[model samples]
Target: MTWNFMCLILSLFLSQFVHSLNNNTTDSLDTCLQDFAFRTLIRHRPHTGNLYNAMLPANLSGMSVSIVRLRSRRLWNRGANFCNFHIPSRTIPVPHVKRLALVYHDFGNWSSHYYTVPGYSMITPVIGFKVFDASNMMSRSVKKLSLNTMGKPIVIRFSNSTLSDGMVSKARCAIFSSNGTLHLGEITLANVCFSQDQGHFSIVVPLKRKRGQWKLWAIGIVLGIGGFILIGYVVIASVKVLKAKKIQVMEKQADEDLVLDTIWVGRSKMPSATVTRTQPTLEDGGLP
Candidate 1:
């Protein structure tokens, strides 16, 4: 009876461990699928009005999957838009993704929807379906594509096939702000080659200047001007002071010279009168 009880207890522990492992696996797989969906949406920006059906293998139909539109205001574009999907979930309007994608999945479909995330400088939106089937499991892994915009504008240029074939094809261009908030739509390109081999595509996204940056520039200019004025005033005042000192010294020297000339003239008259009296005494010699 003792041996039987020990065996039963061991079996129960093993069973619990196995059950926990299965649950962990399922959770990890679900997280991977969500990441795959996000990456797919960002890479091939599809029109927002369309639907995307995930293509899964025959065995994974039981997985529950759904795409939820998460919105929040944060540092990106100063809380004017919500484009970042990787922000922490603790913030208000919590992010739908709880963690970064540790695994990569690829969807075979190429079409997707694009909606503009607000507060960007251009018409930039997180591209994904408004709704998806979360009721079933994903059979195959989704491919991971590069979708990074570190507060930088993405430039997408579309060229016609004829232009690539070395023919004169008319192409149109548009500009968006770095945050993808505003869209400067449908600009006509001049001198564009429509050749089939010479496709011309260029995206000129304008950089956004922050309000604080403008304020800093204005402050620097004002300080620079003020400093220059102050330095000029100091120099001018010094020059005037030096000139006044020089003039004062010159006037003092001139007065001293005038006083010396008057004393020399008075001494010369006294010497002449003394010489006349001595000559008369010598000529008389009366006592001799």
Candidate 2:
């Protein structure tokens, strides 16, 4: 009796295990079908990719984004392309990002369909071309170069302009304790653009700011102005002093001339003048 019961129980256990495996397999298949259906619906929509791509820039952090293709059957034109990347703020400040995005809206004409999608537009690229042939496009090379390059923030720039010329590209971030609370400061970003381009493309290359250069320039300007002002003041003061000395000398000469004229007049009024006049009157009477 004990052997029969154990055998029956063992058979029931095996049956249950097989049934469970079947159910699990069915569930997985259902999930896969659902995914396929959803992706198909997205594919059939008109300009749906464009709308999604437009919204990408708002959601981006430290990565390069581009639109590669639109709706089409070709592998290249079927889906949106995204490049996943994360950069440490301290490693690259103000990244000079040059990553390009492309969109092949239709595969019917492969060459004609190669459209360089705008920054605001959404695109889908061939699954294989998501990174756009990294090997040929130097993707790995750029990535390695960026990783090896040192990045920083707090850059100062100097220019011929009276004001500083340094640009504050992206910043590296750090957390500091303030009043026992964590305070987040500037996080240097590798998304900076240095090109004279009018668009707001993120840059990936790091550049250092010119520091302490402003002080030197300011000091130079101040000294130059001060020297010019001092020289002008001295010249004015000297001119005033020389004019006063000349006026004093002229006054002294005038006083000396007046004294000499008075002395000559006094001699002419002396007693000898009165005797000469009396002698002249006597001679006139005798001759008469």
Candidate 3:
């Protein structure tokens, strides 16, 4: 009966342990799934007075969105300002978009006719936009648009234009966007364009899905390799120490043998004296 009770108790403990382990594994998987479902949103605080906003298209809803701030350009003169915004190859959640657009509000006080050609009556400030995908070796150019002080926003939508993996979008004017969740109809350009003076801008990026778990896995692999190397080094060092101790023990034994040999040689070299005087005294006494 006692043995049966002990076996039952052991089985119960093992079952509880296994149940706890399974629960822990389920919790870990849930955590990973949660992290994978949502992309981290970055907030951009504009330095200039011009307001910048990003939002999803009115039609699409319930989708994860993230906005990344790209490099901005500052316009200094009437001459064309050329700048390139490259989507980093290592960006997590690869950006994939079917449609892209640039929207800007005219905020500059300068008239479009400020820079006039010699023969023409007026010349407008022309903005050119281009998208380049180096991997595919293809470049798409947007028609040059002239900007005027209309106190209203302008939307330049790219129809059937898609940004592939690792593409660069280049613009020839001052534009910017705030960091936010990228959604459909989400214009990434600044609310207002600075035709004159210094201005800041960012590109709107639409990402496919969260892919940050790969980075975590890569880190874990590196740490595991380092641990294995450390363990190997400790094992090698232990082996070397053990060999050195064995050699020391052998050397000690050799030294002891040499000392014993030296003592034996000394004892063998000692001379032995005879008792001839004692024998002659005893014979003389017996004769008397």
Output the number of the TM-score-best candidate: 2
Tell me model 2's lDDT, rounded to 2 decimals. Answer: 0.30
Local error of candidate 3 at 96, Å?
A: 44
How do the residues 152-220 of candidate 3 rate in per-residue lDDT, one tens digit apiece?
Answer: 233332222343324323222223222111112223342212321112222233333558989999999
Error of 1 at 9 (Å): 34
Highest-lDDT candidate:
1
Residue lDDT tens for model 2, 179-278: 1222223323232212111111111113356799999999999999999999999999999999999999999988776532222354474222222344
> Worst lDDT window (10 residues) for model 1?
191-200
Residue 76, candidate 3: Cα error in Å is: 30
Ranking under TM-score, best-scoring first? 2, 1, 3
114: Cα error in model 1, Å: 14
Judge candidate 1 at residue 11 and give its lDDT. Answer: 35
lDDT of 1 by residue, 232-275 (tens): 99999999999999999999998677533222464463222222
In candidate 3, which residue pairs get closer than 3 Å at backbone N, Cα or C atoms, i.e. clash?
A: 57-184, 176-190, 176-201, 176-202, 177-202
